[model samples]
Target chain A: MNCEEISELVYDYLNERLDADCAVSFTVHMDGCAECREQVSDLQHTWTGLADLPQEEPSSELKARFYSMLESQQVAAKPRPLATWFQNLAVFPLIPQGLAAGVLLFAGILIGAQIESGENVDELRREVRSLSQRVTLSLLQQDSVSERLRGVRFSYQSAVYDEEVIIALIDAVGYDKSVNVRLAAIDALKPYLSQQPVLNSMVTFLGKERSPLVQVSLIDALFGTNGGETLETLRVMSNDAQVIDSVREHVRTLLEESV
Target chain B: MNVTDVFSDNELMLRVRDGDNVRLGMLFERHHKKLFNFFLHTAGKRQVAEDLVQEVFVRMLKYKHTYRGESGFGPWMYRMARNVRSDQFRKRGNAPFDSANVETVELADERPAPAELLETDQSIGLLRTALAQLPIEKRELLIMARFELLKQDEIASLLDCSVATVKVRIHRAIKELSRIYHQITCEVRA
Candidate 1:
């Protein structure tokens, strides 16, 4: 490349963005180019000097505020998760033995339901409801349960075509090892996301998780939940000159009612 | 002492994650000075830098769950601070900040002041004024490299760009600074 061409590439060359052959060419030119060498020196000096700039620390009061916030967050998250509670139940020999004994009872109930419409799905729903109620009642008797069970806490919000499938889906979302499975759970939960806890789960997936793929889905969930707020947040991010505004603009468009 | 024994910022952060408040405090103590200095130079004022530094820590705490254990913590914090500073100015309005935190820089700060600056008499007050005039991208490139003492590779990682790009940005920024410095100094001394 000529001097003019090399001059135009000074930034690229210095940054090592140039191919090895081009860089060698550029270095060879630099050995004879006084002005270009000076330019390189100036950039080097400024970058070198920046590291020494002094900074101010957050005040002790501010640190306390941060500390307290973290303390509460940890306290909130430290609970043995709901899944852990259920997983422990899965290992109970007495419960499994009871389930074995209930097999006869379920057979009788299944026979009765099969006589009505042969809908095993409906029968399973009825059985799950009774079992959950019995468990809740037993806890209530022991004075250990939180005692805040809703009348239909175990009832489905929507007329799920396959309650069994949805239960499996929700279970997979909660405990499946793959992030993709959890993301699919978020996707499946979309139509039935009127409840706040499920919506909170969607937000937690998007805002708290580091996986960018999951983040994109979370962004989609945020768009569905509250586009205006999501747009405003993205707008705030877009304000940084260094940030890629095109990404922000794309997010902004998702908030628009046009499409 | 080895670099790790001197002050392991990474270890301190891990301790903070494990709920060691004292280690968090130590992390702050070790980094706050250097971070504040970077903020001061970039912000061109002390209280604003101090406030921004505090905001950075608060944000760090709030987003601790989001830290992916990928990059070293300081670089990540700097990236956060960079985003915060940019967002803050935007929130205030897209107005170009005219007056600096000039009145608020630490009196004890021994870094080169305009009055104390040793340079060509023509460009004495130019570097500061010129630096303030660059677009945020250009200014940030120069500030992180110059005042923060980040190596080119470190800056590349912080900015999530190749070192070549960082080099190019810094080069252009310095050239612009040199031009702006000469212009302002001639004006001030006129």
Candidate 2:
């Protein structure tokens, strides 16, 4: 082996880590070479010297300092109120982030009111809607005309689009004493116009209705449907003199417009 | 201490990374002394060694996400310790190979009692002085191989070199340290 190769084997030889064949070769090389042997002897002494250096113990204060530092870090890492709120928000689905902006804006008030209440969110939302529906139903039964009008307006807030609410609104349109409440009922029912029962009720009301404005509103409500039955209803209402001139004129214009 | 047997170091480190700070305490108890001795030998100052040990755990917490559980924790932590040591050198605006003021640092940490100082062997003191004078690369290799007891293969991985290269470097470093120690002992005798 070359001097360079002998030098590489010296560490393993001093540590007694050389493989069997390598150990034999290393001994043969060293037996023939004084310079490499002296080098190995010096390296052995240095390795022993390094091993003799004291294993110093760190000061006791170090442990105290480390625990203190860890404690401070834990305190710093604790989540704050704003971060907790953000974490709660992050739990919501991302699709809602795009389309739920208006829902979020409305729910934001509810969240603020119920923060830390630990109630189920779906349960809370259902509770709010159910309470609104109950209040609408109760107001519909009030003796005061204005209270019943409020009941018609409140029905619009029904999240479920409740059947009782639809029935109550139809009753308002057909039987309520105040024309304004009946008009409000038509406005409330506008959202449910796609329902077959609402359309049928409005068409049935057309023949017996006395108020020109209510008749006009119903005609306009049904005008978009533009069914053959709606056209016939308008035609019949147009000929009735009891219907106000303006109402009759509107129907004639609507009928003419439809054709 | 049995915790070390219960779970592997990587699992403990992963727990620490996953935000179980208590697991860090377990790891610290397991490896702090070895790390302390590494820093002590490298920096040659008890306070600096203690501070570096603290700094390593802090950076581990800060940079936990970077750790992938692919390798053993020892090499990963030693890599971070090297980085922490390098960052300190950068902040101080100095290269590590510059003459270390380690004698003054060692003297400042604690004063041995008069009898204890007299009883101290001259060769051990001379050895430490020789180690301090060796270049940082050679000193670190010797410290890792001789004191830290890391195998040649682990040192090779740590230095990003072949195992053959690590053996050659370690042999050369030991030779240089011997020459330095002899020169110091001669000067003392004179």
Candidate 3:
């Protein structure tokens, strides 16, 4: 191999990508050429130095964040109860919207009367909570984004900590197609964050959550949480590469203040 | 051996594409460090490199449908990584390398002679500085070819160029790096 040919083949030669005959030719040329030998040696040294550079382990936070994202994404990918209901309902073309509205209105009136009567107050409260949960879930599953936003608002107003309602809100945060709804859902879930399930779900959602607006809100919701999981989630978010700069800075600030 | 360890990256990615996203964690575990270093060397900023690694995985999920079973998963992943790095560059508009932010690897406690250890550390440091000084494209080429150990054809496919072109670029990049390293050494010595 000539000097020009050696130049073109040196990288392959160093990498052992050269065929046997070519390798022999290249080695023979380098053996005869001091300049080529020096060049190859320098390249090899640099290459070896680079190989010797430490392979950094991304903090446990990366694994935490990744698994959290994967979990959250899996959660989001699951068929939501209310959504599935709507999908099943789609098959029944004869279901009247007006009739559905009438049924809800009548139920509201019945619940109001039960409250007015003031008997079996505990039962009435249970019934009210159930109704509120259903309303939130149904609104969250609505075709209209605004309706879903309203559902998030209703969940916050009702302060229903029912597992069903919380799951719906979590779904909205993770799976809602609209960022506005998702942001609102994060806010709605704030009041329930004291509940471990709610806290855990929110932290997981923050793992792979893409919307900067939603991420900031979730981070805000998670502020003041010094629990092991929340702290770790916040730490990961603060250093997370996928997080937007503003959100990362916000988390970093939160983390600093917490310290 | 764990059953998962036996699955190839392409197989795991195929699972990921077909709605088994949890399998992605396996792939992440397998490749995140290498990807991290690739970004770290190329960007010369630890935090940015970290974020780029995450971005690449996120893109893998986002664009998983684009993955073809016929192509090697390494090249596919690196191609996405290249795009992510390019996007970052475009977004930052020629951000300067932050040498101070480059992470120092902890040397193994092999009990080498003190002078030899110091020389090794100094050479590594000088090489890193020279690497940071190279053009981003050259730096990336060297990192992929050397550090990441991506085959030339893999790089060629990743960069959408011929194997010959990739080889020539790798040669030039190493030469440039060597020149820069020697220049820095001279400056330090003087």
TM-score of each: 0.45, 0.57, 0.57
Compose the digit string of candidate 3's lDDT tens values, residues A155-190: 865754465566677777878889998888877777
lDDT of 1 by residue, A79-139 (tens): 4544674576567757667776676576667668766885667657855654553343222
Candidate 2 chain A, run of 10 with poorest lDDT: A114-123
Per-model chain A TM: 0.32, 0.53, 0.52
**Which residue window of length 10 is worst by lDDT in model 2 chain B?**
B1-10
For residue B66, model 3's alpha carbon misses the true position, in angstroms, by 2.0
DockQ of 1: 0.12
Q: Write candidate 2's Cα lDDT for A89-186 as tens digits.
A: 77776755656677667668777776657555865686577568657866885779989988988897886666657766887888788899989999
Tens digits of per-residue lDDT, candidate 2, B95-133, equal 663245756446333456355454247667778788888
Q: Rate the local accuracy (lDDT) of all candidates.
A: 0.56, 0.77, 0.76
Q: Between prediction 1 and prediction 2, which has the larger TM-score?
A: 2
What are the iRMS values of all candidates? 13.7, 23.4, 11.1
At residue A145, give the lDDT of candidate 3. Answer: 93
Model number with the top DockQ: 3
Off by over 4 Å in 1: A1-31, A37-259, B1-7, B94-124, B148-151
DockQ of 2: 0.20
Every model's DockQ: 0.12, 0.20, 0.23
